[model samples]
Target: MGSALVTLGGAESVVIERSRVKTLLALGGCVLFVVGSVAIWRAESPVIGILGLVTFGVFGAYILHALFRSGPGLVVDDEGFTDQSSAGAVGRVLWADVTELGTWSHQGANVLVVGLRNPEDYVARLSAVSRRYARVNLSMMGTPVTIASTGLKTDYDSLFALMNERLERSRLRLDSNPPRT
Candidate 1:
């Protein structure tokens, strides 16, 4: 993942793109898994082969989509941040709505979990597949907006720091200038 601070008009935004090398490596692993599943079917057990195929196939499709998808995986701007880092990304989360920012570990991968005031609103807007993932995220992390740096250009720490900084700035701004009724 590559990240840049871009200024458009008077607003500055941080844009983080996906890493092709990392994505390709993940795709390669998926291919290997599928091949191994085939081998298992040929020699060992059809049940395990079928299970592996279904599991790895879904992952392969997701990785393929990420590989071909252009543009930044995550963007943090003046109003809010847009998360496209994963298949279940909850896009355009306003800083005002974010109640907390915390971390979680999922299968050894560090995940940045954003706590929202109205998580259900975000989950309702997601696609069916994404919604299922969002439900799981809510159950596991207590929020539906969980971002992982699996295929992205940045590390978990950097991503978390950037987001934390932005969220703080937003909160300070809001504190100083209260919304007029």
Candidate 2:
């Protein structure tokens, strides 16, 4: 076999990132939202107060959920990377199928990319993170492939190690193939 890394499956692919900073920001926002909502409720405008409460609930849920799930240690399995995969859970690409491994800074962070023959499957998997249905994993003119980042985890080394190991194991095309445009 090729290089092997002990892949451990868990609640998250990797450890939680330093979400404390983000959590503080979100918690601050949630507190403001709750306060604003309560203020509205007491302002003699029941309608506005109700709307504020609803808004508060939405903001609270989003911030809380993001805080809890925003862990570090994102990993790739036999199928695909954890929770990050749009298609399913695990995603594995045959070496022959991948065009290249691209490194690009997305939203201020470096990401690992794997190009594919048809991006439909990959696009579908990233729908939740994409704003539009037609804009999942895309460059300019539309291409099939995927880009997974370490997000805020900042563990590029570990992520790359796993990815490279997985690719070698899968036998994806490498320098032998032509590069991308």
Candidate 3:
């Protein structure tokens, strides 16, 4: 659907674009959501019906927008990583602040958990809505910033490998030259 990795400015900068196939799949889900919303409305379930209608309506609208949207889902550079791959993703996590990086699965979806030196500072950058979601992620995954591989153009293995390699190099560079006070 899209290139897995795009090197910008030699091999120093790279961007992982979202998959068109994933976007189509999301669009299909939106259609199902609309259908379910209508079915719920007709089944005399007012409370659940209203919730379904509103929830599905908002999600469907966002999916439609995602279909046409195309950009770097994840950006990795010498500085750090910018995760735009997940819903309410964090913008930047500098290499200096990243202490650990790993992945886990929840509800059949793979989640990438990036351990930060100051997690609270990153959590504070989120908007009101994103902050709410981040709290749930923090509770479930123990890290507010988690990337899921579902909508990404690159597969989980490839993304993880690239990230690990870059992180190692960053750590080595940081270790060799301590920051000036």
Candidate 4:
């Protein structure tokens, strides 16, 4: 686990890279998906077998991607935050559009959900499965940007504090300088 304050894209950024735990968990998921795929292949129901194959194909791709993934999983700068932690994450969320920040439990995993001013637009941009999850998050968690802390090297509370502080700063800056008409 490591962290660094570095300049990214001409901005000073706090980069929190993913931990080995995340890599291990991803590998574990790959193994489970493989096993499930094999089990489903042997099942008498053809429909079930096909479903398993689909699951394997989807999760298998994610597993392979995770294996090769590198660099900071999360990056916080003056403008906004970029999330590469979750599969098919929104990529980035500007501090200006961030409406709320809170935590929720999804499948026993603690996630930080960032509410946006216009979640629908972002949700529409996601892939089918990611869009589905985003919708579920909206209905269940009240947000479209749900970030799992499991992948991050930084502690969730500290990260939350940093984000909140930055959000406040962004708001203050905007308030102080209204856009010229």
**Candidate-wise lDDT, in order:** 0.88, 0.51, 0.76, 0.78
TM-scores for every predicted model = 0.87, 0.43, 0.77, 0.74
After TM-score superposition, the amount by which residue 175's alpha carbon in candidate 2 deviates from its true location, in angstroms, is 16
Q: TM-score: which candidate is best?
A: 1
The TM-score obtained by model 3 is 0.77
Q: In model 1, which range of ten residues has the least summed lDDT? A: 62-71
Model 3 CA deviation exceeding 4 Å by range = 1-11, 37-70
lDDT of 3 by residue, 85-132 (tens): 655677898988888889897666666788888887888998886687
Q: Give the alpha carbon lDDT tens digit for every residue of 49-159 in model 1.
A: 989988899889878877887778998987789998767787889999999999888678888889999999999999998898799889988899988787889999998
Alpha-carbon shift of residue 112 in model 4 (angstroms): 0.8
**Lowest-sum lDDT 10-residue window in model 4:** 59-68
Report the alpha-carbon TM-score of model 1 versus the true structure.
0.87
For residues 1-181, write the lDDT of model 4, one tens digit per residue: 3568898678888888877676677667767866777777787766777687687667667555655677678898899998887665777889889997887765766678798999898889888977876787789877778876666787677777878888888899999999999
lDDT of 2 by residue, 72-92 (tens): 324444444433322221233
Candidate 1 has an lDDT of 0.88
Question: Looking at candidate 1, what is the lDDT of residue 94?
Answer: 96
Distance from true location, Cα of 68 in model 3, Å: 5.0
